[model samples]
Each structure stands twice: as structure tokens, then as C-alpha cells.
Target: MTGIVTLTAAGAIDATYRVGALRRGTFTRAERYTREVSGKGVNVSAALAAGGADTAAVVVLGADDVRFARGGLTAPLLRIVEVPGSTRVNTSIIDAEGATTKVNAPTPPLSPEAWDATLSALRDELGTRPQPWLVISGSLPELAGTGTPVDLAAVRAAAREHGARVAVDTSGGALDALLADPTGIDLLTPNAEELSAAVGRPLRTLGDVVTAAREIVARGVTTVLASLGADGLVVVTADRAVFARAQAPSVANTAGAGDAALAGFLLGLTRGPAATAAGADPLAVAAASAAEWGAHAVAHASTIVAGPPHGIRALVETSPDLDRVLTAEGEA
Candidate 1:
């Protein structure tokens, strides 16, 4: 089906612990615990699938851990490629105040041969549909001997070959490389911090964000969907911008909210014609959906969403107040 296909170059076994409080250099007791197979692309695919979208995740796992990762995820939704060592483990700690502290282990670069296998798997999956949306999310690993990042350009090339659109959600050097020449990127989802980092300045107001997003839009990216925490989300393009926020829910965990938001955005875009027929701009529809789905994700303690979202209402503004101050992440 021509829906969404995701690539998770660095996958992990996620371990979450809920504690009353975290004390540095001291023992802490956890009140709850859960674990699952997780990666940014995995989370996006899972959320989209739960929301009834045809989605699949291409995950690279170690030979020893592939079985365990497979056991936790739906079989049809996964395309696993095996490497040599064990898969990395990431730990998350949520406190009583709903704050999340995450410790992610470093992933060693895949060998050139293994990297080729990963690309082959990606090509195989993309070949299944004429023009699927290919999402490459999460941290990227380097190539072993070269110490160079995985060939993102090659991935973009493959997507182009299959006439697929691309959405990227990664950070640091990998993100810089993509933005350096965003020729094939149709969409980019960067949270507040990532957006700040991209522009090399702090964004304290709605206008600041719009300016930064426009800079990237001018660089060839079609759309920039930025998450602003409590301030909500903003979608910016070359000619228009929209801001959307849903009624707040009691936030239990914010770990996977962005991934869920990206899933919703893709779903909305995939079904854009229906939204357009209803007299709404497809961009605004997507922003509203993203806000609602992100709200739904924050209400849960895990990255997995078992069902469709409910009880969430979004307010989208076509002409958002540019002067409005943003307080999320202490921006202002």
C-alpha cells in the first residue's frame, strides 16, 4: 500500500521505569516498569498502524536480539535486517511530576557491507508501493571503517527512484547534512530545541520560529512541522504558516509524543484530499491532527498507543499571533 514506510537505522530495546523521585547517587524505587522494542521510526510506524494507516518500519537489529525485538512488535509491520552485535538498550525514567529522563546508549557504526544490506532492505520496502512516504527517523549510525555517516543522499536517491516523498526527523550532524541540501525532503519535524539548534539561535517567540522554519523552506524543504511543547505545534511553508494546539491533557509521559505527532501529520497528508474537500487547507488539517495525536501520546506512559485517540480537540490558527511569547522549554 502507498502509505508510510519508516527506516530506523539505530533501533533499541526501551526500558522504562516509573519512580516517585530520582535522587542522584542514591537508590530509587520504581513504582512501575515497562519495556518494548522502540526506535523513532518504530514508534512512528506503530502509531500510524494503530491509527489504521498502512505502515511498516524497516529496523536494523543485531543477530542475537532480532528474535526478542520481533516478539514485542507486530510481525507484518516489521522488516528486520540483522547485523553482528547485540541491539542497544535505552533507559527512561519518569518521575511523579511527569518529567522524563532518558539515557540512550551509543550505537556503533554498521559495517559497509551491513550498511548496504540496510539500504537493500529499504529499497525492497519502497518497491512495494509506487509513491509511499518514506520516513527516515531517529539517530543515524556511522559507517565503521570510514567513520562517515550513513549515506543519507543514497537513501534520498532511492526514494526518488521510486517516486516517493521523504520525511526526516533526526538531529545533530545527520540533520545538518540533510538540511544542507534538502532536495528530496518533503517534510521535517523538529521540536523546539532542535529548531533552535538548526538556526544557531534561541527562539523565544512565534515569529522567531517562523523565521527559522522559513530559512529551511527557502533551502528547498517543502514544509517544517515544529513541535513547541506546551506552546503546541507550528507548520510553516514558503507561503503560509499555521499554528495548532489541542486542549491539554494530564501529561503522564512526553517521550514519544513527537513521534506520535509525526504519525498523525503523515496520516493527515495521506488523506489530504478528504480534508480539502471539506473546505480546509490540507496543512491546517494536518497541524490539528498532529496536535490531537501528540496530546493523546502525552497522556500515556509508554511509547505504544493501543487505540485511536479520543477526547482531544485542536484549535488551529491560520494567522497565528507572531508576537506571542513561547514559554515551553524556557524559551522566554
Candidate 2:
């Protein structure tokens, strides 16, 4: 799979505000202001492209918001579908302590005609293009009379029809919908909290995480890659289960770490014959790759702002970190 496609929401500007402290009726200075295109799918696609993958991003942008949508893209191929209104804008405020508060604007409703047009464009591209990897991520904007549901099953089916492997990173109702029918999903990458929410249980230990992940695979998922934050990652498949532990690093911003991790994992999936042979059981490799990328992302965040930096080397040096945690908790 040389080419990859990412599908999700596309918005214009990301207005980021930084405040030193929060208090009622107090004037605070703005630390930084910048505009950028941001979304989970978009970020992941950009990371993959930056990492040297033949990648494209498919997004819905209002006719008026085309410029905004295209502004933040650096990918070689970016396909946009013009809809009725301007794309959404998301605002985030980061406090000095690295806590973030975000507000997202509502997206214009997509008419039946608009949906058809967008789907048609995607189908044509996938059918005619050489992309072999498809990433369906992020949340859909609410539109009038539209429940904001993304047709994951249809997306998966389409990717498979075009001989592409699919990876999904989403949550809430959309996550529930995909888990309802996990067929055709080559990889399900979820963070620990998301995984616990999806499985309807609290996963406090590595064994618990492994058990839950295996249950997810039993539901027709080929593989389950669970990101355990500072604890590293837990990968589960029908054949084997492996855990990779990275020492807790000072995380600058946990925001894009998951997306970066996904990028790393996908990159590993397409690496070479060994990765291909590992097939769905490439959890360890994926985890290792994701850890490195995520560490980089965290490190990058630290230099620009006052926050925790993800220690890439520390994570790699700590082997069996998860095992140690499990053993200390008497769950190993």
C-alpha cells in the first residue's frame, strides 16, 4: 500500500489562545495567536505525508471556506468537496499549566445532493487512484436533519472494494457504530480511556486491557492496538498478544500524540516484508514506531511552549514497563 487517503471533517482556522491563569473578571494576556487547519484526520494525514508517505486528504469544505481548508494542507494531493456554507472553525485555549479548553463551531448541514457529490468524488478517486490505505477518523459536524453520523461501514466496504486496508480512530456514537460491525477494519487504534469506554469497563491493568482488546478482536476486528499513554501500548490479535512499554515522558501536549501514534503504526504496517508477514499482529512494531513519533511530537511542543516534553529515549529504554506496572499491581 503505497498511497493513503484520510477522510474526515475539514475546517478553516484554528484560533489558539494561551492564558497565563484563569480567574473570574480578570484581564489576562494572550500568549500566542495563530491560524491553522486542524482535525484528527487532517493531522494524521499531514504527519504521514511529512513522514514520506504518498498520502491525500479528503475533506468537506463549504464553497466559501475552500481557501481556509486548503491553507493548512501540505500534502501532495488534497481533494475538497464544496458544500453550502463555510467550513467550521475551532478555537482552543491553553492555560500556562498545559490544560486546554476548546470550542468548535457548528458545520453547515450537507444536503442529499452534497453528500452524493462528495461520495461520488471519493469513489472516483479511490476507484481510479492507486491508494491502498484508507484512514477514516475524527468527528463529523452536525448538519440540519443530519445526525452527524459517518457511514463507517460504507467507507470500509468501499476501501475493501478498491483493495485498500482501513484504519479507524474515532469515538462516541461513531465508535459504537463501527464496533457494531467490525468487519473490514484492519486496525482499531484507541487510547486507554476510549478503549475502556468502548468496552464498557474500567481497564486498570495490562491483563485487563489485553482481555478487553481480545474481546474487541473476537467481534470481527483483525487487530486491536490500544494506546496506554505513559504506560505504552497493548496490541492484541487472535494469534498473539504483545505489550510495549515506554517510560513516562513529560508530555508537552497530549493532543496530537494519538494521531502521531496512528501515523507511526500505519507507517510500520507498510514498511517491508517482515511487517507484511506480521500482518495484523504487528502491535509491537507499531507501538515502537508510534512511541517514537509521539515522542517527537511531544518534544516539539515543549520547545515552543512551556509544557512537558515527551522523552523518546526514556520510553525506548524502558522495556517491559507495562509488565512492571502489572506486577506491582499484582495483575501480571
Candidate 3:
């Protein structure tokens, strides 16, 4: 089955430490730890593949692939493109209160040829097996020869040629390119801070988020899923907006929660039409699933999303936790 294809520009070994209390200027011993082959796009692929979604992960790594290979980080398909430096280790300190502090190492700059090879590999994948979603994720590596970033426009254009909808989960310079022209992206996932940075304003209220998302709609982008951390997520489309929340049983690791949300939303979209409409737009049902999947992710000690959430669709479609936002004051 043709399914989601994710490209992670900067992939890493996620090293997450669970600590009792994170104190400033003191040594905090980790109570437990876990590691996985992860990047935003990789995490999405892992979630989808774990749930039996036919998925592929395109990742850029250094020559050494053994680190990622050793951890049983098996997805349906994994495409690795060698770059200049070693795979960075992203460390996260998860305190008992669910607060997380992450230290992400910078990926070494890639040569021009490396970028070309990466893009070419993705284009070939798009042509060989077309899928509904082509996800371009994570931050851009610094270009060695010049400051010109990786050509996301080229990537999106390639996906369009193969008749695949594009979904992007990137920020900083990478997102700035989309804000300039978001013509073909079907879904854009960004947290509150990333959205605020993209629009050059603070999204303090639901009204502010709605307004910002609408502006992107004006640019021809189809959907926006803005994660509000513990407050849940706000999903905006051309027709309407909705807010959905799912309280976690226990918050163990908050690192990959947003990736889980994006994966769930996309998975729900492919799960077929809802038996009954819960709100104005069908995207609301997907958003509800996104919220629930995110909650399940945080309840686990692992940063990589696990198996299929069998009852997520039924629960989200029937539960009272999801609400369509008619007015700006809509907060779930």
C-alpha cells in the first residue's frame, strides 16, 4: 500500500533521561532512560509504521548508520543519505513534573552535492511509489558553500509532480520559505512559538491563533494544526476551526507529542470517512485523533511513538472533549 513518505533533513539519536527533579546548578541523576532513531519526520514514520501504516522514512546521516540500526528502530522502509558529519545526539531531561529541557546539537554543514543527492533520492521515491502525503520535516542544515538553504520549493514541486499532497513540520529558515509562498502544502504543523515566529506576532489568545491561521489560508495552504502544549491543539482549515484536548493519564515524555499528533491526524485522514460527523469539517475528527494520540505519546517513557491506538478514532469521534470553534473565544 502506498502511504506517507517522510523526509527528515536532520536525523538524530534521541537520548531522553527521566529525572525526579530538575534543579538549577545541581546534579540531577536520571531515574531511567531511552533512546531511538528520531527526527520529527522519522518519528512520524515510526508512529505510522508501528500502527501498520505503509510508511517510509528518508533520513540524512553521517557514514555511521550502526547507532540508529542497533536500537531496533524498524519502520517499513528507511532510506539513509550520507552527509558530512556524525549523527547528532539530541538529549532531553524529563523531570517528574513533565517539564522537559532539550539540548540539540547542530548538524555539520552539508556540501552542495549532498543536498542534491538527498533531493534526488526523495524525488525518485515520489516517482516510484506515489503516496498521499510527502512530509518534509526538521530543521535545515547549514549550507557549506553558501547560505542558501535546502530547496524546499523544489521538494514540494517534485511531490506535486507525482500527485502527492505535502505536509511540512519545520521552523526557522525552513518555515520562512513556506510563509513566503505556501501554495501546495496540504497541512502545516507548528507549535504556538513556531507559529508566532512565522507570523511575527504573539498568539496569546484563540482569536490570535485563528487570525494567524486564516492569513495562511489566504496563501492557499489547506490546513494548519497548531499545538498548544498541554492546552491541546487548534486546527484551522478553509471552512472552519476546531479545538480539541485529551488529558494524558501520566506525562512521562513530552518530546515527540507533536509528531504523534501529526501522525495521528494524517493516519485518521486515511482511515476513511467518519461514520457520523462531529463538527462542521471532517478535519475536526482528524484533529481530535491528533489530540488523543499526542496524549498517548506523553504517557510513554519512549520518545518514539509506539503501536496503533486501536480506539482513538471511535473515542475522538464520540467523546465530548472535541469542540468546533465558532467564535474566537473557543478554547478547549
Candidate 4:
């Protein structure tokens, strides 16, 4: 793939509030507030575009907000799919310690017809670029008439037709569906908890995580990038696994670190090949870049990369310590 094209099945207007330590059941006033048109795919696309990568996002927007979506997120990077409903507003409360408390609204339902239209739009966008990575992020809303989850297979089919590799970032039943039939998906990004649930086991140590990711690789997925908040990232392929991490200078917000990491990894892929640490394996290079970008994301208050990326270094291990115990704080 030469560039990236993201599809956000569920999009939102993210409202973030900065406040002191939250007092439960009391009126906690916010010290600052910021709003942005966001979704997991939108966040990825934003970060990639900021890094000067060719990227576009196909977002499902409520008809009421479609008119204003371009004003917030640039029109060039976004392809809007309007459906009948009001856009959901997701709220985030960041405490003084940089801890985030998020309240995500219920996903707006989409009819099968609307979903078909959305997929058609995504396919059309993919055609615009010769070869692009199709990144599907965010939760999949159910069909209004059927009450069944959105069909991810259709998305894979669309990607296959355009010769695009698919990368998925989602959980719950959606994750189950992806795992049940890992046909066209090339990359899967899951946090520690999601990986544990995928293998139906508890991942107490790095070894457990690696072992679990291998199972996914065996199933058909080309690579699994597991996010371990503080512990950094673990990338597992069929033959090898590598771990990468970087210390964050500060933690201002962690809402979109994973998305930023994904963007960084994809950017590395778009730049031909990278050979920094542990030889010139694309996976290692991408993992190291992912760690560095994720660390930088937490240092900013916005959900997406804001400006010029500062210099940051990452430690990549070709042979990671499998027995290392995972800490409670490493949850992502």
C-alpha cells in the first residue's frame, strides 16, 4: 500500500474537559475544554496527515452534523457518509494527574442500506489511491432493522477488490467476528485486555501475551500489535515477536495514544522500509516508531498529534524477556 485510507463506522464530536481531582457525586468544574471531530479512524488519519503522509478517512456522520464536519476536520482528508440521526458526543474528563475518565455515548444505529452506502463510499475512496492501507477503526454499530452487528466481511471484500490491506482496531463482538474469520485482515491492533479476551486466558506476563498473539497469527492474521500502556508495545508475527517501548516525558492525555501509534507504524510502512534497531526488519522498525509516537501522544492534550513531532527514542528488543511480569498500570 502506498498510503492509508481509514473508515470510521461510528464517528463523534469529542469534548474533553480538564479538571482537578474528580470528587465523586459532586460538581467538579472543568478548568479548560476542547472539542474536535473524532473517531478512531479520524484520529489515525489526522496523525498521519500531520506527519505529511497521504491519508484519507471515510467517516459515518449523523446527517445533522455532516454539514459542519468539514469545518472541524479538513474536507480533503474526510469523506462524509450522512445517515439519519444526530451525531453522538463522547466526553472525556482528564484529571490533574493525567488520568482520563471517558463516557462514550451509545452508537447511532444505521440501516443496512446506509451501511451499504458507506461501504460503497469507502470503496470509491480506495480507488482514488493506487494502493492504500484500509484502516477500519472504532466500534461497529448494528443494523437498525436486523439488530445484528455490522458485517465486517463486506468490508474485507471491498478492500480485496481494491488490492488494499486491511488493518482493524476494534473490540467486543466486532473483535469476535474478526477472529472468527481472519481472512483479509493483515494487521490487528489490540490492547492487553483485548488480547487476553481473544485467547480466552489471563495474560499475567509478557510470555502469556506473546503466546496468545501467536495463536492469532496462526489463525491467519499477518501481524498482531498489542498495546501495553506503560509496558509499551509488543508486535507478533508468524516467525518472530518484538517488544518496543519509550518513556514518556509527561502524560497529558492517553485517549489517542494507540491511534497515534498505529499511524506511526503505518507511516513507517509507507516510507518503503525502515532499518533502525534490530537490523532492518520492517516489523521492528515500525514497532519502534510506534512506541516513540505513542509516547509523544500522551504528552499532548489533544486527541491527535498537534504539531511538529519532537525527537524521541525507543528501545526495541528482538528477544524480549518473556518472564517479565506485567504491571497493573500497563492496562491500555
Most accurate candidate by TM-score: 1
Q: Record all residue pairs in model 4 with backbone atoms less than 3 Å apart, i.e. clashing.
A: none
Give the residue spans of candidate 3 off by over 4 A: 274-281, 310-332
**Candidate 2 at residue 75, lDDT?**
29
How far in Å is the alpha carbon of 72 misplaced in model 3? Answer: 2.2
> Per-residue lDDT for 2 in model 3?
48
Q: What shift in Å separates residue 262 of candidate 1 from its native position after superposition?
A: 0.4
lDDT of 3 by residue, 1-332 (tens): 44788998888888999898998999888999887778888888888887677787888877775455544655346787876546888999988777788999886677878888888888877777655579988888877777777677678778888899899888887788878988888999988778888788877776677778888878888989888776777888776777787888777788888898898888767764552454444566677778888888888788787775554332333232333322222232
lDDT of 2 at 257: 69
User: Which order, best to worst by TM-score?
Assistant: 1, 4, 3, 2
> Each model's TM-score, in the order given?
0.97, 0.83, 0.88, 0.95
lDDT of 4 by residue, 1-332 (tens): 37789999999888999999887999988999998888999999998888788888999988888777877745668888888877899998999988899999998778888898899999898898887899999999988877888888788888989999999999999899889989778999999999999999899899999999999998999999999889889999888889999988898988989999999888776653435443687777788888988998889898978653577889999899999888886254
List the candidate 2 regions with Cα displacement exceeding 4 Å.
10-12, 24-26, 73-75, 106-108, 128-131, 141-148, 245-251, 274-283, 301-332
User: Model 2 Cα RMSD, Å?
Assistant: 4.8
Top-lDDT candidate index: 1
Give per-residue CA lDDT, model 1, range 1-332, as digits (tens): 35789999998878899999998999998999998888899989988998898888999888888778778755568899889888898899999988889999997788888888889999998998767999999999998888778888789889999999999999989998888888878999998889899889999899999999999998999999999988999999998989999865787878889999999888888778887898878888889989999999989888877666888989999999999999966432
119, model 4: CA deviation in Å? 1.0
Which model, 2 or 4, shows the larger TM-score?
Answer: 4
Report the C-alpha lDDT of model 2 over 154-228, residue by residue, as the tens digit: 566678789987888887777887888888888998877788888898887877777788888999889887887
